[model samples]
Target chain A: MSESRGPGRRPGRRPGVSDTRGQILTAARTIFAEKGFDKATIRGIARAAGVDPALVHHYFDTKEGVFIAAMRVPFDPAVIVPLLLNGPREEMGERLVRFILTVTADPQAREPVLALIRTAVTNEQAVAMIREFMTDALLGRAAAALGIPMLRMEAAFAQMFGMLMARYILRLEPMASADPEELIALVAPAIQRYVAP
Target chain B: MSESRGPGRRPGRRPGVSDTRGQILTAARTIFAEKGFDKATIRGIARAAGVDPALVHHYFDTKEGVFIAAMRVPFDPAVIVPLLLNGPREEMGERLVRFILTVTADPQAREPVLALIRTAVTNEQAVAMIREFMTDALLGRAAAALGIPMLRMEAAFAQMFGMLMARYILRLEPMASADPEELIALVAPAIQRYVAP
Candidate 1:
């Protein structure tokens, strides 16, 4: 596939002939917000962007890829995955919890993650996309690296997800207002039990 | 107040006063859905209901009260509070987890609670109302009965809340489909650490 390019770059409706990827992303975001993720399809997005469905696939590969690109989370899971994997196994819980707290401490930095969560709850497509991305790129890798079952990794993640929702969204007292260090100390052990090899 | 009431004839809008309460609830719900909890005021609800704002106050003491009534969950915290407090301290975690699972297992019963969670995320007023109700009626009583710190009880609750969100709302697998007994076994010890006397 990489050997087909010429110096003139033949401009036709064929794949890689035009740059309509950004337009498709914009259309996808609008449709996702209006109709939600599950109902919004590649064909609909392509129609909105005035492009062929094949072009959408050529650029983004899948709806999930378009979502991940559109959502644009503030940090890269790739970086966090390695950090969690390379850490001391015993202290992995604390490290992961602390990382979540640290990253989310700033309101602006936390918006994209929150938006993804909000969208996920409302849309099955978003849930599947997030779950796949999280499992394939981050949690699954960590579980394999630590030699723990995938279920255990998911449980630990579920707890942390709930904790974030309670603190940031529900604004429950003490849990919401507690020092991050204190919370890390309190919750890390529970997480440890789940993720520990 | 009791002295003012006659034997067969109670005075001053006793309980069923022209079905205004129900009307107010409907209006409050509409307004809350359209404008969210914080932005939807008692005056706005009264306006929507075509009643005087004073009538709204007489019917439901505050906006929080109106929101709670509008978002009426099927179960009563009063009943569950006694159950949790009266149970053996060691088994409180299992009892609470089981209770949450059992109640939420039914889709009809779970809808209001899920609605409350969805609304609370977007609206601070909803959060404050839910948090107060949870703390004052349920968690606070359990903490006092067990002689555990309120903060610890809150942390335990936060984890359970997160677990529910992950399983039901986020549809995170394994946690979503895990057998109740297995989940009880896995999470009870963690909950016990937070609530145990």
Candidate 2:
């Protein structure tokens, strides 16, 4: 949809919808960097983007949504949370392991996630952003939905996170070169214990 | 022990044992960085340090030992493998988790390990160095000693590695703040499965 343009229609006077969305994302990145995830508000991001707060909400439903968009994460919790919950409880671990490994198997999709992880390791601001988003939007929601303890969920996440580091970043073999099915078989049972009600 | 000082010896002529040890570590770091863990050799490191290869062997029993010294890893496989194997088979997981968390709890001891992990994520050479060292020195030894498959050992390590990332780097709460004993309770069983004969 196009924004109404005044008669003058100067190139800079009236921005398009995409332009506003881009502006919001850019502002979100800067604000997230400066203030981190906890302190960065939608209002502040909208103000920085020169847009109304309502517009920011229209584009991204919540702060977590905004962060995910700004970070260009390949998968969305909106999508992933349901996937985790929809499966039979016993198979949750297998699904989680398979989904993560399969999604990250593609280098193009994995780069942004890996980059964010690398940044989180070195930068406190990045860590804050990642921590809040992961806890609130991802792990918290999954744990609450499944009625599992938050600690268990975090532990499960940690296990998968480590496996990814081993497979992709560290390239530790057998883990690195093993077929996806093999890893799912080896790791799923352990993950099952973490998520079982 | 003091080295003999020949007549007309200058301050630089006869280095103390600690100084020579430091020189070897310095050279090991450079060589490992340049050639990665696999290509780097003890002879090459000794030659770079202007010492005999035999001296390098005398000081560091193996190339992995040189890497451990150069990296300032808080724990050594020489100590850890035995610990893992000496324990009751079922309790190995608990011991492993407790040991890792306890050692890394000290910020002073954890920094170098975390720094290495941070470096490994972004740098190809660092990844190679970590991969070879971990596969050969740590996981290989433990898997062989326990008579378990290498894949199982690597997976177990991956779980712990990821937990460390969550606790220390990501600082994801619950996992980050949970009592070490509590974690041992939750995680030990999964680890037991991996290491069990």
Candidate 3:
């Protein structure tokens, strides 16, 4: 297929590329949904996208990277993790709480997250991907930076995770509709107990 | 249909009819799953179960009642609510945490609950049913008994709800395998602030 496309076309650096990346992402979402995270592969996604395998790797460095892109998560852990670590240790809990709320405050921005939550509930592969992303990309960095055990970090993270589900997904009242500052005041202390350096 | 069955047949009462209630419950689950709680009716459930609508009403007085029965949740609010309220105000959080862990420890017993959680994520009607159940049957009674505003009660409940999802559904490690007592110690204080009378 690659040979038939053109004589001068290179797998890694295809010239005049316009929508190839977008097209690959479209195909990735479908393939990932159908085969799940564990079974879906770069080659399979490339084949589905009608692009070369090397091209898929060139555009998205890894499967997890592809997932992060396809899911359209607004903030990258690469940026957020460092920001979380750089903040004052005593206030990290409040910062973390504020971070989540600030990001999810916009309804349009929250769609991908809500979709991920819904999908993660039903799909084991999604769960695995989510867990990996949280532990490796997000929480692990915070734990490392604060010199705390990952378990402590995980407990704190779990509370925040629960809060998100309750307030957003379940729309549990009071917490759901409460002023963000009030909730931060209420929940930040609890989170601090786990996260405080 | 009553006449066709026979004389001496009671719409609400049939002797040696242990399975009638059970069959209705089975049918109710199916109908609820298919049409959701709002649209599933006593007549529809009865038809599916090959019974009379009067029998469903006789066995379960309301749709909420039928749902509770079908879910097979071991703890009844009538009993547990009093137990929660009677405990020391400071210990209410611990008791609540213990209650959730105890109820969900048995995987078989937790099946219906986990199922409801998963279903409620995607279905608005299911969310309504769940919110009503949690607010009315469970948390409302607790708040009333504790003499606290429902808003405080809801905040605490949301935290617990999130923990259950993270531990059971997402299976995020450490929390998933943590000692129940340790978790209770960690989370009880947070809950007490909400429920303390």
Winning model by TM-score: 3
The candidate maximizing lDDT is 2
TM-score of every candidate relative to the true structure? 0.67, 0.69, 0.71
Cα lDDT tens digits for candidate 1, B68-111: 88765443666666767786878988988888888878654565
The CAPRI-style docking tier of model 2 reads: medium
Residues B80-175 of candidate 3: C-alpha lDDT, one tens digit per residue: 787687767678889988988888887645655666666667667678777777777877787788888877777777677777877787777777
Each prediction's whole-model lDDT (CA): 0.72, 0.78, 0.72
- Stretches > 4 Å off in candidate 2: A1-67, A70-72, B1-72
Q: Which runs of model 3 end up more than 4 angstroms from their true locations?
A: A1-66, A72-75, B1-16, B19-68, B72-75
Can you list each candidate's DockQ? 0.41, 0.62, 0.44
Task: Write candidate 2's Cα lDDT for B1-197 as tens digits.
Answer: 12323223454766667778877776776676555455678999887777789999999999877877877555578878888878587789988988888888876456556656765765575678777778998889889989988999999998898898898889898888999999999988888888883
* Residue pairs with backbone atoms closer than 3 Å in model 3 (clashes): A162-B162
Collision count for each candidate, in order: 1, 0, 1
Instruction: Provide the global lDDT of candidate 2 against the true structure.
Output: 0.78
- Candidate 1 B-chain TM-score: 0.66
